[model samples]
Target: MTESDAATASLRPTDAIVLTGLRVRAHHGVFDFERENGQDFVVDVTAHLDLSPSAVSDDLSRTVHYGELAVEVADAVRRDPVDLIETVAERVAAVVLAHEPVHSVEVTVHKPDAPIEVPFDDVAVRILRGRS
Candidate 1:
């Protein structure tokens, strides 16, 4: 599919797998400590694809293997050091959408302990990408 196709693959109730609260310690930030000392980043991913094939065959191979997908996401998050959460989210989305069944990806990166001077509960960046 083209970029537009992936971009327009809106989430539907029937064919989506959601993973949430997958926290990992990663060095991603604009400041020195962010890369050097690192921090906890919480990732939430929604993978959109047709589940009918898997549903009919009752085969794990027919669907996205979320267990392996989670590992790939965590590795992507913790391994590389980026200055922006947007990049991080994109990387995660790329991994999720790599599967043929996944037409689109939704990634949310949470920086709860962001180095903000103001008092706040959390900060996060969310993005959606379609198959490229």
Candidate 2:
């Protein structure tokens, strides 16, 4: 799909599997000190898919396995460090979309301990991705 199409695509109006507040330690930042010290990155993911088959048949295969997804997301975050949380969020979205059952995925990567001189609650990057 074109970039515009992907950007405009709406998430499927179906049951969603949501995982939140997943914390991982990684060295990702634009500054040397920030990357060297490392920091906790919080992730939130939402996968949209049909749950009727899984709900009716009680089959784990019919739906996304969140347990496995979380582990995979953690591993993705721990991969080679990048300078931006946008990249991190994209990595997570890629991992979630890799699951066949997931029609669309929403990923939010939160950098709570960001090296901002100003006092702020938090800094995060959120993205939505879907199959073409």
Candidate 3:
């Protein structure tokens, strides 16, 4: 199947997972100053899976454990300080895909206090990852 077809097939209504507003402090940026002085980072994640097992078993182990996923993202960001938010977003996506039963993942990383010279609420990077 084509990539688009695979992506469309993964978006099953019954299989929905979301991890929102995950706050972490990480040093990530192009500038040296930004790297030295870490800043708050926010991440939002969505995972798609087959929820039938979880429904039948009524067990948390049958589905994705979002709390563990959140910790993994935080650990990755803290351990691997990159030079750009794009890299951070990609790394987070990779970590999520490494988990079992995750057919597709979407990650959004937000930098609330960016070093931009202009005024803005926040800067963010969003990426979608799926099984190939």
Candidate 4:
């Protein structure tokens, strides 16, 4: 199959297209030191929906506005200090699900600068939500 054919084939009415590793700085952690000394956070978002409208119309309006969604996630992460990445992920997923077009949402919050004694890349939490 050609590239265009593959692209089309990959899309489905219920398929989810994921945006990963979206880095944002936010104060999230259980330690008091972490909340006080804010650190960089990374987030991944997956939006599940029907892609047929955007696929056919080739119009931005027919699809979930990823740019707007990114901003919303960032804003939610920064709004109030959280003590855990789990809480951040849960909140972000809730916010994304509020968008009507999104049938389901998955959010992952990563904290690279977690206050662990051993060296580590990061710690993260993942949460999933779906419309009823």
Off by over 4 Å in 4: 1-13
Candidate 2 residue lDDT tens string, 1-132 = 987766566565468999999999999999998789899999999898888999999999888888999999999999899999999999999899898878888899999999889999989999888887
Write down the TM-score of every candidate. 0.90, 0.91, 0.89, 0.83
Q: Which stretches of candidate 1 lie over 4 Å from their true place?
A: 1-14
- Model 2: lDDT of residue 131: 84
Deviation of model 3 at 89, angstroms: 1.0
Ranking by lDDT: 2, 1, 3, 4
Sort every candidate by TM-score, greatest first.
Answer: 2, 1, 3, 4
Taken over the whole model, the C-alpha lDDT of each candidate is 0.89, 0.90, 0.84, 0.80
Model 4: which residue pairs collide? 29-83
Model 1 Cα lDDT, one tens digit per residue, 50-72: 88999999999999998999999
For candidate 3, what is the lDDT?
A: 0.84
Query: Which 10 successive residues of model 2 have the least lDDT summed?
Result: 5-14
User: lDDT score, residue 24, model 2?
Assistant: 98
Q: Which has the better lDDT: candidate 1, or candidate 3? A: 1
Give lDDT tens digits, candidate 3, residues 1-132.
997777677654347689899999988888888899999999998887887898899999988887888899888778768888888888888888887888888889999988889999888999887776
Which has the greatest lDDT?
A: 2
Residue 99 lDDT, candidate 2, scale 0-100: 89
Angstrom error at residue 16, model 1: 0.5
